[model samples]
Target: LRETRSYTWGLVIPDLTNFGFASIARSLEAHCREAGIQLLIACSEDDPALEQRVVDNLISRQVDGLIVASSGHSDDIYARIHDRLPVVQLDRHIGESRLPMVISDACKATAELVRDMASECGAEIYYFGGLLDLSPSRHRLAGYELGLHRAGLEADPARVRHRDYQPSSGYQLMAELVAELGAPPRGLFTASFTLLEGV
Candidate 1:
């Protein structure tokens, strides 16, 4: 018998149709190609059960590594095998996930955006964010609140909406907000481009 390297890895993400995720896949594929590793991508569609199934499938295939953008699932399932499997969480994370993570400074960036908007608009700001169950959404909302506090403004729960990341939801939320306020908001912050599309 001889030792062999399969030179493969698996990636699990919420949605392939999302521009952010697609761009990530492109860059990752290029880097993997340079290193002579085959990259296998799986879409979880933000479903915990489907994500687990894909992850298990990848593990069974004996891939050397995994990158996951989990959908509210804990890391306990992978904690036991990570020493051999090398699981890495990406973009999103479970609360205090045991796996190593690679995520951006979403909170800082969102807060900065809020400040700029407030400074320029001098109007009430409303945030259209995704499900708070995900880390990214929670961080962004926290940033929004922090930004308002820094601007000497109180955080208004009525102005902040936490919903799913879908254009239809975005559209409906905006419509209902306008109906409730009797006018369009002066300052608006949408968490994702897809959400912005609906606006």
Candidate 2:
């Protein structure tokens, strides 16, 4: 019998204030500690350039592996790190880069939320924030559509306002939904936690 040990891993996340990513980081840190491996954590503030710098810094620190919470411009960073080391994508996946990923079932959750909104409130739903270029937003939208269909409602592309996931963008999108949909959507789905706060 052989005793298994954890490997030192570097975690690059979007923001520390991001509860979802933080929760994942905290869990991973505990796991690493238990396994006697060091965990290095870095935050990018959703900036690709910053992410790249952090990745370089972490690599230089001689971490055994890496985990990145994907964000805009992350694809480029992943591309740069693709073969240099073994990297896991936490919370987002890169198809071409072949990075292992752990993420929420956004598609399933979206469908469920939309269905609930439709059934409970007969409420028109509008998903705001984040361009489809991002993973979570896209999956959530797909889920929203599924939920709409389940509720015997149709999706109106106009109702969905995709933009940078920010407080200002959410506020603007909310305004648009109010004007275009003839009312604010009874249910609003936001892509990022900050966007959720904005709403």
lDDT of 2 at 65: 81
Off by over 4 Å in 1: none
lDDT of 1 at 81: 58
State the C-alpha lDDT per candidate: 0.86, 0.77
| Candidate 1, run of 10 with poorest lDDT | 1-10
Q: Which stretches of candidate 2 lie over 4 Å from their true place?
A: 1-7, 72-84, 175-184
**Lowest lDDT 10-mer window, candidate 2?**
1-10
TM-score of every prediction relative to native: 0.94, 0.83
Q: Give a tens-digit lDDT track for model 2, residues 1-199.
A: 1433246678998878766777888898999899889999999877777887998898888777888876653466666666777777777665455667778899998798889888866646777758576777778889988999999999988767787766777677777667876866667778778777666
Q: Between which residue pairs do clashes occur in model 1?
A: none
lDDT, model 2: 0.77
Error of 2 at 113 (Å): 1.5
Candidate maximizing lDDT: 1
TM-score of 2: 0.83
Residue lDDT tens for model 1, 21-138: 8899989999999999999999998888998899989988889899888895577877865878788889987888868999998889988888878887664999999888899998
